[model samples]
Every structure is written in C-alpha cells, then in structure tokens.
Target: MNCPLQGERKGSVNRIMRELNGISVVVPFLNEEDGIRKFCNTIDKYAEKFDFFLELIFVDDGSTDSSVEILKQCAFQNIKQVKLVKFSKNFGSHAAIRAGLQYASYEISTWLGSDLQEPLELLELSYEKIREGYNAVYIEKKSIKVSKANRIFSRIYSWMMRKYAVESYSSGGISTIVFDAKVRKYLNENMEANSSIMLQAMDAGFKSTVLSMDFHERSAGVSKWTLSKKMKLFIDSFVAFSFAPIRLVSIVGVFIFCIGVVIGISTIVNKLINPNVPVGYSTLASITALGFGITNISLGIIAEYLWRTYDAARKRPVFIVSDVVTIKECESDTQ
Candidate 1:
C-alpha cells in the first residue's frame, strides 16, 4: 500500500527489525511495479514459514516506472522485512542479482525473480538440500511460458553446450534450487560480472542438485527477457561453461592441416601419373587462392579466440552498483 519514503534512508521498515538470524532473500527486479507487492507478500509467507529473520534485499535495476517507488513504500510500511537498493541504470537481471549477493548479510542467501515465478518454497527445498551436503542447487525450469520456437532453440543451444562449451553436463527437468553461501561466494568471487552464474555453478565441480518446480506466468507486467535475449543467454551459457568454441576451431585447424598434407601427397601422385597435366596456370591459381582463403579463415578464428582471452584478462567491470541494503550486525550477533 503506497507507504511514503523519506528520501531512501536505508529502507525505512517500521516493523520490528527482529534479532533473529540466518537466511537472506534476495529478489532482483527491473520494472516490476505491479508484481512487487505480491512478491513481497510471498516473501512474507516464506518469512513466517522459516521462523528466521528474513532480509528481503530488493534491487531496483534502473526502472523508469513506479517500481522503486513501490519498493520504497513497502519498506516504509514495513509489512515484512525488506530493504530497497536502487541502481542508477538497468544492468540486467544477473548484474542486479550479483549486486544483491555482494551486500547479502546472511551466510545462506538465495535469489529468485520478483514475479515469484521461482516459488518461495524452493528456498526451503534448497535449504534442505544444502543441509544434506550439496554446495549449490540451481532451479531447473520444469515448464515455462515459452513458445515452441524458443523451446527448439533452447534444445539446440543446450545440445551445442554439451558438445562444445562448459562442463558438468546435466540438463532437463530442473528448476528453482538452493545451496550454501560457499557456492554463492565462489561464483561472485571468480566470475565475470556480466556472465550467468548458472553455467559457472555447473563448471565449478561442486556437488549440485536440481529440484523441479512449477513455472508460473508472470503475475504482472511483461517479461523483460525476450527470444533475442534468450539466444544471447544461450551463447553466454556456452562461453561461460565450455571452451568448445575455441576447441572446435583448434580441431578444425588440425583437420585442415591433415587434409592439406593429403592434398600434397595427391599432387605428388598426380605429377607421377602425368608430368605435363598440371604444370599450368589454371590449377596453380585456383589452388593458391583456395589455400590462402582457408588459411585466412583459420587465422581469423584463432584471432577471435585470442580476443576472447584478452577480454577475460582485462577484468573489466561487469556491473556497477548504486546502492545496497543487507542484514544489520545486531542480527549477525545471533548467528
């Protein structure tokens, strides 16, 4: 309900900021004005279920709408435990979530969408798995409101991933998941800010499990992610997880080299068969042009691979955070 804000003073929740400890609920959003309330309500439900002080760290990822205002209102009213962190620009979902993770107060932090599509109940399931000794548990999308084309592309992309990029090959039938802070820290510690953590989690060699969950339609507003975005994510998934693209280029170069050797042997046999057959311009010109073109293509691929390595080495900023709200230390004392 439109709670007033006092110029964003570290989230003014009038509710008793309880002394209970453990668990941080991080929800990152971009233009989720209508869904924030319901999302907060879901957080309230989970808060009650857990009996631990729930620190709902909500990131407003450069929303032009009333989303930040809505979060400010919720924080002011203090229905439950929520802290608003507003970013200066839209850095996308992964960046927003990573920002939230950096400021997370509790040792056990989990993230989900602001739409509540990744069910709050998954947190409990994830926690249970963590208790059982898994480092990370990622949400496996069982079913989604995706189109047929998207599904096909996803299948093809995932297949390519298995064949070429990343590691820890596991797919299909997994959704909202949970794990310890160790896993989260591992990801934030050694990942590209713009890269997806899901792939890194797979490659980290951590014992992980994926729990299935019902994918619900967005409760409000439009999905920020589109097909193009998904395709980009698909590429990111491959680059993030596997070096197959680079490896594929390397393998192709080797194959081409072998083929060139065989062609050289064939030319010897051709000369032996007919010494006057190809001491001419036509064959020489064609072979020279073809060989030059293939060599250039192979060199170009190698250059691309080198550029990718340069990108990794630069350590450029993937995300810039404008604000953060985490668990207060008074709460940390209890933990």
Candidate 2:
C-alpha cells in the first residue's frame, strides 16, 4: 500500500481530506463476516456524536469467508472514507494492522478489532490525551473478561514484559492503542515482521498516556487468537525487544557449571574417603541428562535471536496486499 500524501506509482493511493478534523481507525479482521455490519453500525452511531470525521480502514487478513463481500456491501454514516485492504493469505493481525497504518491520513490513528470488544469511548478518550501532547495513548484493560486460562496467561505475559522487556508497558497488558501521526508514521516506516507493534511503539520513547478501562465481552465471531500464535507473539516480543533471554542463558550456564564443580569436588572427596565405594551409574546418568536438557534450552533461546536476525537480513515484506478498495466521499460531503 502507498504511504499518505505521496505521489503513487508502485501501489495505489486513495486520497482523503487530510485537513479534516478526524481520527483514522484501522480495523483488522479474519473471518468476521458475522460482525461486519454490526460493527459498522455501532461505529456509525458513535461517530455521529463526534464533531470530527472518522476514517475506517478495514484490512481482511485472508479470510476464507464472505467477510469481504459483506464489508463491501456495508455502508457507514458520519464516516469520511472507508478503505478495505484484502491480503493474499493470513499474514497475521499485526501485519494487517501495519498494512492499514500505511494508508492512514488523519492527524490521529488507532486500531480496533472487528469483534467490538473495545469500546469506541476509548478512542475518544485517547484523542483527548493525544491532544494534551501525548504522542501515544494506550488503553490498558482494568479487567479482562476472557476465560480463566486466557486471563492467567495475559497477567503472566504482562508481568514478564514489564519486568524483563519494556518497563513502562501496561500492567494489565495493552490491547487498544491510539497514537498521533508522528508515532504512526514512525511505526509505518520502521516495520519489523514477527514483532509486537505495541511493544515497538512503547520502546520508541514517545510520550504516552495509559488509560485503565474495562473491555467488553465479544459480541460476535470467535477470536482468531490461538494459543500457538500467542506463544509466537510471546517469543517474538522478547526476541525483538529484550536481551534478557540471552542473558538468562548465560546466567543458567554459569549456575549449572558452579553446581557441577561442587558435585565433582564432593564425589572426589567421597572417593578418597571410601575407596571401596562403587561409582554409581545412576548418578552419572542423572547429571548427563540434566546437562543436556539445560544445553538444549540455552541453544533454543539463542536460535530464536539468530533466526530473527536472518529473517530480517533476508528483507522479506511483512505483508503482501492482494487488493485494495476505497469508498470515496464527495468533496462537498467532506466539508
């Protein structure tokens, strides 16, 4: 997709009134046909109350359903423009959101999920905070009404991230974020695949404000966030931002080596004291297995960093856009 306010030759550019008082919203979805119309209607009602305009950028991340068709058929009230980006295949939600950011035109931009779990009020509140000179506004959930297992995972992940990675990361973890054009442009230009965009934005040292809010339960469509994908995100967040894991490997290696030294000394002293004692194979086998296990884990952590480096070196595109559709508004209507 083309960047905002540039002459386009490589990809198409869908023009909007850049000077309009508005916020651009990027909604990324996968197989959310059941909620498209309802989401649009809800946003429309919310937008009707705003004095500023709204730009909705919907990115379809390779949904094998009627989502695109339903999206195309839907209409919005009080929205300045509607842009749809259809990916060739499932490129992941972060990739989809990044794709939408490339086309953002307003002074402020934020992303929301198609499930409508996050309230539109968060966007408005974020806008106010951004106007107060914060470059980014993070909506941290006061309470997440997800499953017990998911909530536990979220808490652990959030704590780990704050402890080892970004110190300023939200305690409850971040889901919805709103940033001004400056941060948005920075994120768009500096894109890294297999990385957490939220973490990336936070690590950039931009002035950010966090709001403690409650997120609603999903009103429609099942979530596409699988456990394996969450694990990948966890690994990616650490690998991309923190060296704690690599440092941890070193720490564990040193610790294990010290223990081995102590054990060896004890064994030698025991042998000298009791020459009749037999060297136990069970003890040796246990030590061997423990050493191998630690070694493999250390190697695995190192490999994560190396693989990300190799992937970045290859300069692969984070996402491939197969199609783009823009619903334009009349010049008079924009005014």
Q: Which predicted model would earn the best TM-score?
A: 2
Residue pairs in candidate 1 whose N, alpha carbon or C atoms collide under 3 angstroms: 139-175, 139-176, 139-177, 140-174, 140-175, 141-174, 165-242, 166-241, 166-242
All candidates' TM-scores?
A: 0.74, 0.94
Compute the lDDT for candidate 1: 0.65
Per-residue CA lDDT of model 2 for 1-335, tens digit only, reads 12233444333323344555579899999999888889988998888778776789999999999988888887775776789988999999999999999878788999999888897899778878988999999999987679998999899999999999999998788997899888988998899999999999999999888999888899898889999999999999999999999999999999999999998998999999999998888989998999999999999999999999999999999999998988653223432
* Model 1 TM: 0.74
Per-model root-mean-square deviation over C-alphas: 6.2, 3.7
For all candidates in order, the CA lDDT equals 0.65, 0.86
lDDT of 2 at 18: 51
